[model samples]
Structure formats: structure tokens, C-alpha cells
Target: MHSHPDDKSLRDLLREQWTVAPVRNPGFRAEVWARIEAARRTPATWGAWLRLHLLGVSMVAAASIVFAGAGGGLLAGARDRHEREQLVQRYLISIDPHQSSAGEGAP
Candidate 1:
């Protein structure tokens, strides 16, 4: 890399910036305290509460939805399994006359 004759080195430039102090605002502290007091005085609102507990609320809603879907799927699977069993029993009965007579007598 090439350097300009007038340009200061990176280290020197950083040192110069680091030594310079920031200007202080006279009313900065009082303004911050006033805002804090105002916030404290205000009543808690629904929107603020929701914002504060947004992550928790969303997690609960998602969990409820997942549970509802899983329950529905389980019920559907059970009903389908029961229907398939009935279908298989009917098919077996239709194919054998002796088994059909025995099943009817036993039931």
C-alpha cells in the first residue's frame, strides 16, 4: 500500500480521536429522569403488556395450535384404523361361508 505524505498513520489518527472528550449536555440527566418518571406515572396498557410478553404469548399460541392439530390427526388416524379393521373383517367373512356362520353364531 502507498501512503500520502500528509496523511497520519492509522494508530496516530485513532489516538487523536480517543483523547478527545464528548461534549456534555446540561439538561440530559434531568430530561432522562423526567421521562422515567412520566413512564412510571402512566398506567400499564394492553399493548405494552403484549409487547413485553410477546415471545411467551406467541409460544403459547403456537403450542396450542400444535396440540390441537396433533389431537385431530390422532382422532382421524384412529377412526381410519377402525374402519379398515371392519373392512377387513367383512372381506374375510365374504370369502368363507363356514367362518361367516361361526362369526355370526359367536357374536
Candidate 2:
């Protein structure tokens, strides 16, 4: 049992708070339902949709970009390989006239 000078006042304040009734707003429930209905009626915008699925959409876009870059690199590599092979064949034919005539006769 500790006694302080302010303890009694504190007890009285707590008692008053405990006995006080909370004020209720009658329109609160109706207002909440109205807001819910309004939200339901409104169509979602593209910005809102993007925000909701931002993670999935970003992953898909990144994958598409990566695949496109890889495909482009593969195509460029194939083209370079074909050109190099053709250049080697032309060099060989220039040095060997008989080889060029044999290649022309073959399919």
C-alpha cells in the first residue's frame, strides 16, 4: 500500500473515465456502408491495377526484355558466323581456281 499525494486524484480521474459513456454517431454505420458501395461501383483504373499487380507485371516485363535481348544476340551471332564462313570459302576459292570450278559443278 503505497500512498502518494496525486494518487487520490488519479483514482478519481480513472473512476470518472470508467463511468463516462461513449458517444455514438447514428450515421456512422450508414456512412461506412455507403462508402463500401461507392467503392464497389467505381471501376478500377489502370494505375490502380498496376499498383496491385506491380510485382508480377514487372517480372513478366523483365523476362520479356531478357528473352528479346537473348534472341537478338543469337540472331547476330548466327549472322556473323555465316559471314565468316562465306569469307573463308571465298578466300579458298580465290586461291584455288580448280576448287571454285568443282564447287560450281556441285549442288
Candidate 3:
């Protein structure tokens, strides 16, 4: 009996037929170099970019903390029955009763 080709063998065959070539666009290269020079000349623009990046990073960090506290119940510390009940109550209060009852509140 003949054996069928496996996924790995097929992938190897496809890879063997493929060829990769470096991109060569002189116009695009020149545009990128010009942008680089322009950026270097504008120190204030670089500083503004850095400040905006830092602000964005801070916002992301704050949002991550809030999301973790909200979704993972990280602020609850441990799984006690009373805390769990309170959390469930808060969730029920926030959501529509029909939706909450439909098991949409499981997570």
C-alpha cells in the first residue's frame, strides 16, 4: 500500500518552489532617507513624538490595570463566598436581567 503525503512534506515541497527577492524601489528608498533627514533636523518634533509615546504608554498601563481588576477580579484578593456573591450582585445590577439569566454573564 502507498502512503499519503503529510502536511510537513507538502509544506517542504511548497517552500522548495518559492523564491524570495529583496525589494528594490529607488523612489521609496529616497523618500525614506529624506524623511529620516527631516526628522533629524526637527528636534522638537522628536521630543513631541517621545512625549506622546510616553503618554500613550502610561494610558495603556492604566487601562491594563483597570481591565485586570475588572475582568480577573485581581482586587478581590482571594475567593471567599461573600465577596463572590457581592461581585455577582454588582454584575447582575449592571447587566439586563434577561441577558444575565441567559448565561451571558458566566465570564
Per-prediction TM-score to the true structure, in the order listed? 0.46, 0.52, 0.31
Model 3, span 1-107: residue lDDT tens: 66467778867877998888988786997899999999786657766777758888889999999998786674455556557866776687578566455644465
Q: List per-prediction Cα lDDT, in the order shown.
A: 0.83, 0.84, 0.74
Please list the residue runs of candidate 1 whose C-alpha ends up more than 4 Å from where it truly belongs after superposition: 1-48, 100-107
Greater TM-score among 2 and 3 belongs to 2
Winning candidate number (TM-score): 2
Could you give the candidate ranking by TM-score, starting with the highest? 2, 1, 3
Superposed model 3: Cα runs more than 4 Å off: 1-29, 38-52, 72-78, 82-107
TM-score of 3: 0.31
Return the lDDT, model 1, position 7: 72
Please write out the lDDT profile of model 2 over residues 19-50, one tens digit for every residue: 76689999999999999998996658988878
Residue pairs with backbone atoms closer than 3 Å in model 1 (clashes): none
**Model 3 residue 70 distance off true place after TM-score fit, in angstroms:** 2.6
Model 2 steric clash pairs? none
**Candidate 3 C-alpha error for residue 4, in Å:** 44
